[model samples]
Target: MSCPICGAEQQTKYRPFCSKRCSDLDLAKWLNGSYAIPAEAAAEEEEWNEADRSSTEPRH
Candidate 1:
């Protein structure tokens, strides 16, 4: 198989990526949100916000 990042032949150690550099590059993309799965907007955004606000408010 070829590397997904650089199209080089995949190494045995890195089956999907040819080298550690390519593997780390892919990880960085994920960590930085360069790759994302599509999602529909939540139908209850207001309710969710209210719950979050209530949780953070001081109890008194």
Candidate 2:
């Protein structure tokens, strides 16, 4: 398999990535939201319901 970030042949040490740099690059992309999927408007309603449910639950 090749590195998704640089197309280098994947090394056993890096598994899906070819090197530590590529792995870090991939992580940076996620941290910077470069890999984020666009949220649908309906997701907000679901998030609000989840928050309400959590707030109503008693903490142990």
Candidate 3:
């Protein structure tokens, strides 16, 4: 099959990518939020907001 990253023919070890370089590139994209979707669920947003608030607020 063709590699999704570079459109090259995929190697046997990297079925969806051409080689280790393409695979690492895809992983870097994922880790840096390049592939993220906008807006999570309301509950998740609420949770994130709570965490942010806690981090910024002073201890009692």
Candidate 4:
């Protein structure tokens, strides 16, 4: 299999990563919030955006 970080061949120990460096890089990304699961905003936030948008839109 190939490493997700650098696209190199994966090592047995690292499995999906090529080396400790690549594996650590992945972990760092997670720790620093670079890798994240997408989610929708909360109801209140959505409502706020709706009100904001309405105020900015030009009248028909």
Number of the top-ranking candidate, with lDDT as the measure:
4
Ranking according to lDDT, highest score first: 4, 2, 1, 3
TM-score of candidate 4 against the unseen true structure: 0.67
Distance from true location, Cα of 32 in model 4, Å: 0.3
Question: What's the TM-score of every candidate structure?
Answer: 0.67, 0.63, 0.61, 0.67
**TM-score: model 2 vs. ground truth:** 0.63
- On TM-score, who's better, 2 or 3? 2
Cα misplacement distance, residue 11 of candidate 4 (Å): 0.5
lDDT per residue for candidate 4 within 12-51, as digits (tens), equals 9998899999999999999999987877667879999999
Model 3: clashing residue pairs?
none
> Over the stretch 3-48, how does candidate 3's per-residue lDDT look in tens digits?
9999999999987899999999999999998997767598898999
Q: Tell me the spans in candidate 2 whose CA falls farther than 4 Å from its real position.
A: 42-60
Q: Which ten residues in a row have the lowest lDDT in candidate 2?
A: 36-45
CA lDDT of each candidate?
A: 0.92, 0.93, 0.92, 0.94
Backbone clashes in candidate 3 total: 0
Indicate the residue-level lDDT of 9 in model 4.
100
Q: Cα RMSDs of all predictions?
A: 5.0, 7.6, 5.9, 6.7
Error of 3 at 32 (Å): 0.6
